[model samples]
Target: MAASPSRRDRTLSAHHRKKQPEQVRRALLDCAAQIAAEQGASAITIQAVAERAGVTKGGLLHHFDSKQALLAAVFEDLLDKMDQEIDRTLADDPASRGRFTRAYVRACFSDRLLGDRSLWGALSVAIVSEPALRALWSAWLDGRMARHAETDGDQRLVAVRLAADGVWLADMMEKDGGLKRYPQDFEVVLLAMAEGGN
Candidate 1:
């Protein structure tokens, strides 16, 4: 048999072996999101994500034991980021409910500035594939709607929330040839809704 591996070789190997579970998970989720954005949510898979992230199958498994776990992580990441941005936007004017709504609309439709659309697409897939995720999203939406209602009152807030959802869904589906066709018009409507108007 050959001599034992050198100390340097062992050190280097150990360094490379470090799992960095959180980093790996983030990388895998980002990769999945990118693929989803490019080819739709149906294209996301463990093998594909591993390849995109430049990690081996075993390495990916070290971070997320299964595809379902990975998908859940993706959804959690997106929702957390969205919540952070919403908080930041609302922090500027906590007293003005209209400002909060405006910020929320801007956060959602402001292009890829928020987060990769692939992540959102992955979330869309997760919602359908996993019932728990669907429940989580529904609960989150209900909370958001309740908060909006506190500010704008019941009826108007409901309309605004529905309209905002419509806008978000339309944008996600790339319907009407994407937002370019009516970005300005949509923005106006969003602002109006935020302001509790038509």
Candidate 2:
């Protein structure tokens, strides 16, 4: 005869028997990101995230010690995705000069962060308003800038990067048509500058 599982075992199984620890952690981060994207960062309570992620509060705690920690982790995850997008963009370009800067411009214009209604757009409010998140973002920017110092260090390239950032910021804050309101050739001009053109 087969033996039946006990209450504790059933509870454990219900929580995450099929998912590995990493999977659970990933799920938690993804759930948090979705909540932040849809409802803004202020809505990301631990209880809300845990319930939405199909885990108990204690289970979520096992992965993230506190709400602030979870928010930081979610922000880091978003930055990681941005890094991947930049890397993919870099891979397609053959030019060495201004390569990293060009990738940065491309990423800024990418759908992931282009407008107020985007996932990154939803999260940008937190990135700028939350002190902890802003610190993390600053550190990340500093590191990338340092790494690309050799290739993207030209003054003109730096100016182009700044322009791209301005456009992205404007788009994020725009309540109307977003990036479409900008000149159609805006990105092209940035890319041309990235390529060291007139």
Candidate 3:
């Protein structure tokens, strides 16, 4: 039996409504990131984010109570996704220190991460505006670096860590010209260092 048009429409509409919350949340975050990327994090107000996301202010507030909370969520989201991608990248060669360093660098520079500069900008502002948030971010990076050091040792890991930070900073600042020469050259040097080159 063929389904009536009204019934088919209702079924699809119900499915859409069921999926709307997640979609709205994603939209809100995307909009917030755009605002942060375009005008810096200080410009990301709830109203502005809502407008950018094509949602009402009430709808935005329904998902996030305040700007601080939203910023926290954004940072958390970026970190969590990065962690997952790194984990997946390292899964096959867990014991290869060189592979781990390469995977880490690739993840940092990947299109997925680079495309979310707003999240980076927001995190930067959060660090200055909220000391605790900064501390947490520091702790997270320190722990990751310590793990890298444990695996790759002080010398190689130090260079890798510094390079990672430099790459991220250059990208966030849109200083591509200044950083253009480093990606290939730095990776070669870093890989050699990781492999105990002189």
- Scored by CA lDDT, what does every candidate get? 0.68, 0.82, 0.68
| Model 2's TM-score against the true structure | 0.85
Ranking of all predicted structures according to TM-score, beginning with the best and ending with the worst: 2, 1, 3
> What is the lDDT ranking, best to worst?
2, 1, 3
Cα deviation at 144, candidate 1, in Å, is 3.5
For candidate 3, write residues 103-184 as lDDT tens digits.
Answer: 6766655652344454564456556678657766788777776776556555666677578767666655554543564554
- Colliding residue pairs in candidate 1: none
Off by over 4 Å in 3: 1-20, 92-95, 111-132, 142-150, 170-174, 180-185, 196-198
Q: Which candidate would rank higher by lDDT, 1 or 3?
A: 1
lDDT of 2 at 161: 84
Better of 1 and 2 by lDDT: 2
After superposition, which runs of candidate 1 have C-alpha atoms over 4 Å from their true positions? 1-16, 112-130, 145-149, 172-174, 178-182, 196-198
The TM-score measured for candidate 1 stands at 0.74
Model 1 per-residue lDDT tens digits across residues 153-187: 55655565567666667555664445555463676
Per-model C-alpha RMSD: 5.0, 3.8, 6.2
